[model samples]
Target: MAAEQAPSSNDVRTWERIDFHAHLLPDFYQRALTETGEAGPDGMSAAPGWNVQDALSMMDRTGIRFAVLSLSSPGVHFGDDAAARRLARRINEFGAALVTEQPDRFAMLATLPLPDVDGAVAELEYALDVLHLDGVAIETNARGLYPGDDAMRPVFEALEARSALLFLHPTSPPNHGSVSFGRPRPILEFPLETTRAVIDLVLAGTLRRSPRVRVLVPHGGGALAVLADRVATLAPAQMDLGDVDVIAELGALYYDVAGMPVPRQLPALLQLASKDRLLYGSDWPFTPIPIIEAMAAAIGSTDLLTDADREHIGWRNAVTLLPRLAALAH
Candidate 1:
């Protein structure tokens, strides 16, 4: 895997790179976190301050032509069902305005108030039908309840009915304190939680049933491909997977090259995901700017991907996943 010269800003300007896993931090959302006393939710530090211009500048510097935004971990839901519903609407509205302001450079996924099924279903309908947002972004677990829980079936059904895209982000796992050892959960637990949520969806038949609801898994499917074979071999006998082909099901979902995907995670991810299912992501504000730049450079320079594969992951695949992007292209 020889390295190629990183593309310069001029060179990058000519290409279309669509970031599918970027985030936004609206002022109202920050205030909600503080008011809820969840400023340090999941054991991480305070939320990073973000502004539209700064986000645009980062996209330009990294050669990203467009970014699909979502509200990140410890999502809009705090504890109160009503509060969660209100915050979800506020975040969605804020994101929709950004897209309206710059349709070519920005798109947004709607936030939902999960763990409150009826509210979530209503919000999903409004976000997709009324707001005309690209898709929905949801936490892997909503306050310790995984999306695959039977209680979430209606939400998945609603998404399928709309053929909506689902962006799955990870938050701290249930009872993470028991395993976290006082460290921030993102370091290790985030990936593990993503893996767990995906498997649960498969075992619960959520993925099988909701074929139209396209799911985008973050961080190269979060150690999922690495453990896929293990689950495929043992899950049926030990658990009640009931004929689910773990590898095939995993391969069907889209995955983003966020976090540290290059050198190691990407290879493992390819074992389960086809090249067309790969997408680029720069989990900005959460992953600092310098790291995002370095990761973008590495993706451009990595020899493991052919020029064709690079093109697909950079933007082609994203366009296929969200057709609205092609319409928005300049």
Candidate 2:
């Protein structure tokens, strides 16, 4: 792989943003979706066609310097733990190889075979230590089990030990009837599910127990900004929170402005967390390039966030989270 030339001062006008929530659809992952015969498992009408070249073109056009890749919805395991394990390893190897080649353009959050506790743990160990991935991307709920479930404690413990970066991606909610009331899932259910999972993690004391784990949540933390007060009020009484400050903990975690970052979403997120807590994301492949470009334009036009705020969310905060990006920032 050829080294990307350091951007000229004028080139900064292009994609200087660091995308924390981009995805990679490995051929095997696409095969899984095809084999299942599911039409847009993420609630879209059908799966979007994706390839490395397409992603690169979109990134270059939109001013994204580096995109941290993760597998999107329906994650690694599709009701088969063993198959998921193999797929996870293959995906990790593929992503690691890409990072090795680009080093500047891409980094990856390893996909683990979750809801398969032992396999997840083993994969996490190898992906982080051996493959040298930046971190792991996890579903809000894994195979009908939320990340906060006591069953996944060992995995959380391992993440805490490594102080790993955990990027939480929302999944299709199980039993999606009412939420699906002829409405698109990403329009309603996706953000709502992310809210539910984060609530579980907070109320279940998972965040409290795993203090060292730096979490990165997408879609500006979904519904968290809207529901912050409710969870803040109820969590302490319902859970054994000890001395932990619920609001502070939530504020400390990272959120990415991947979807429609303006209007109500960004403002609400700002109220919940400091500006530094926010990161930029494009949601490429799944999100059309036009929408991503629109998001960038919106951010540029917005009066709510200052120049410093834009800089932080664009890539500064992300570089702070993953230092290797700093070297590539030029």
Candidate 3:
């Protein structure tokens, strides 16, 4: 196969995109999920299937120059600490192999066994130092504990120490049974879950303390653009924020335009987050390929963004955050 030619300035559809929110559901990881009775996670009927060829084809069709793959929601931890540790190693190794095989087309974020701080820290070390994966991807909440919880401090500290790029994907909130109303959790609860995690991180001063860890929030920050002011005004009165500016903290983070971010979500996000921090994301395999194509088209044609802004979102901003992409390109 011939390498794709670089797009000319006028070629809107052929913009080389770097997808920051793509997922990989390997058979081994799926088997782990199934054994734990999470075959249908967060109310979905079954986990989406994935393979390298199909992913490569989709990337070629959609003009994606590179993708950062991750393990999606319900993560590796399923109650037992030892099982979670083993599963995390398996997942990271799988991703590292993929990246090694196709360094130009793919990069991977390592998975960690969260809620078990010791295991998570150890895995983080091995993943970064040994496997040499790009960074870490963590669920919004791990076994009912949000990222800001005191127990997760060590994990955050380790990530900060390494100056890691952290990708935040929302999982089913701990109280899904009562709030989800029996619907698939991704439809309604996922966005709210992302919002909840961000608020918790800000309120608990986690973001303030972990200044070096570059964080990417998925789904255009999950209703954060609309709700940020409300949280800013109301949270200080209720919680001891200790001089943390809610809006500032929210604005400082990076965000990906995955899962229908244009028209409403992108504009809302722009009001809060800087344009330079925005990146493209396909949320593929889980989101069907047809929808991914349509969303890419929408991003290309949307009048909301200038050509420069579109180029930035497509890949420039991502290269800034993940310098490995730039290094690989050379």
Worst 10 residues of 1 by lDDT: 7-16
Ten contiguous residues minimizing lDDT sum, candidate 2 = 7-16
Best of the candidates, lDDT: 3
lDDT score at residue 231, model 2, on the 0-100 scale = 72
The global C-alpha lDDT for each of the candidates, from Candidate 1 onward, is 0.89, 0.86, 0.90
**Candidate 2, residues 172-203: lDDT per residue as tens digits?**
78887656886667777888888889878877
Using all chains and alpha carbons, the TM-scores for the candidates as numbered come to 0.95, 0.93, 0.95
Q: Alpha-carbon error at 315 in model 1, in Å?
A: 0.4
Clash counts for all predictions: 0, 2, 0
Put down candidate 3 lDDT per residue, 176-278, tens digits, no spaces: 9999999999998999999999998999889999999999999899989999999999998988878989999999999999989867788889889999999
Return the number of clashes found in candidate 1. Answer: 0
RMSD of each: 3.5, 4.6, 3.3
Provide the global lDDT of candidate 2 against the true structure.
0.86
Better of 1 and 2 by TM-score: 1
